[model samples]
Target: MELELKKLSPEDGRDVYDLLQALPADENGFMNPANGLSYDQYRDWLRFAAACLEQVGVVDGKVPETIFWLYEDGRPIGMGKVRHLMTEALLEKGGNIGYAILPSARGRGLGKKFLALLASESKQLHAGRLLLTIQNHNQPSIRVALANGGRIERVTADRHYIWIDP
Candidate 1:
């Protein structure tokens, strides 16, 4: 299936909520919400996500972030977050990009394609290089990063820091 990456928008609230609902709780730490949320709450969250692109709201003491939805034939199948600017704290942990494919859409190389799309977007934003960190056991993500020209820069106890030039 052909896939495309689209920035999150207000009109995508319902689709975004559905995508979130379709994800497993432990799929990706940042993409997972601890509890179920009503549509209204999810809409509010979407608003915040959109505002993050402008660095208007502060969440967890980070910079503004841009979120993108991966779509296949107009259907949301995955989501990714790109931090426009990286702070010291983010450099150490969060990295510049984060993404997760829906549970039903895994094992088809979508993850690699998602990161490649994010890399292109990052380049357009003037990001010289992108930082991606994945859990040590997340072989799938690691492979995705590596396949997208990501090099292992460092390794912490539970995370692997990969860098890719966009």
Candidate 2:
């Protein structure tokens, strides 16, 4: 399948949020079981996504940064976010990167490709190490991380944090 990655725009928020909302509920209306974000949290997350995209324009005075919105067959399919470096939570569990593939696009290799794209961008940022965390039971995510050279650092009930050293 052909997928294109584009810089996310504020107008993309509605579409992104709508897509996230349409995700298959895990008996709790959340895309991931490990994510305890309530409906409102999801809403806020969409807004945050938009803000992140806006920030990318001037991200530390660097224009044309590396945040991307994945499109499959010309339709929005996912979103990928890359932090310049690792944060405390990221170092511990969240990781320096995070990605979400549309529920309908899960089985495809989009997530892996997205990770590779982020990793390449992180490298440009002089990042020698990248972190990615996923829920232990999230086999697909785990597989994606592993496929992208992620080394299992540790596993927790809420997540399995992996380290990706470029």
Best by TM-score: 1
lDDT of 1 by residue, 42-102 (tens): 7777777677677654557867778888998789988788887777887877789988898
Candidate 2: stretches off by over 4 Å? 11-17, 24-67
Q: What does candidate 2's lDDT look like per residue over 8-123, in tens digits?
A: 55445456556555544442112332144555665665566556544533344333223566777777777666666554545665566767777777786888887887777677
Query: Lowest lDDT 10-mer window, candidate 2?
Result: 26-35
Model 1 whole-model lDDT (C-alpha atoms): 0.81
- Per-model TM-score on C-alpha atoms: 0.90, 0.67
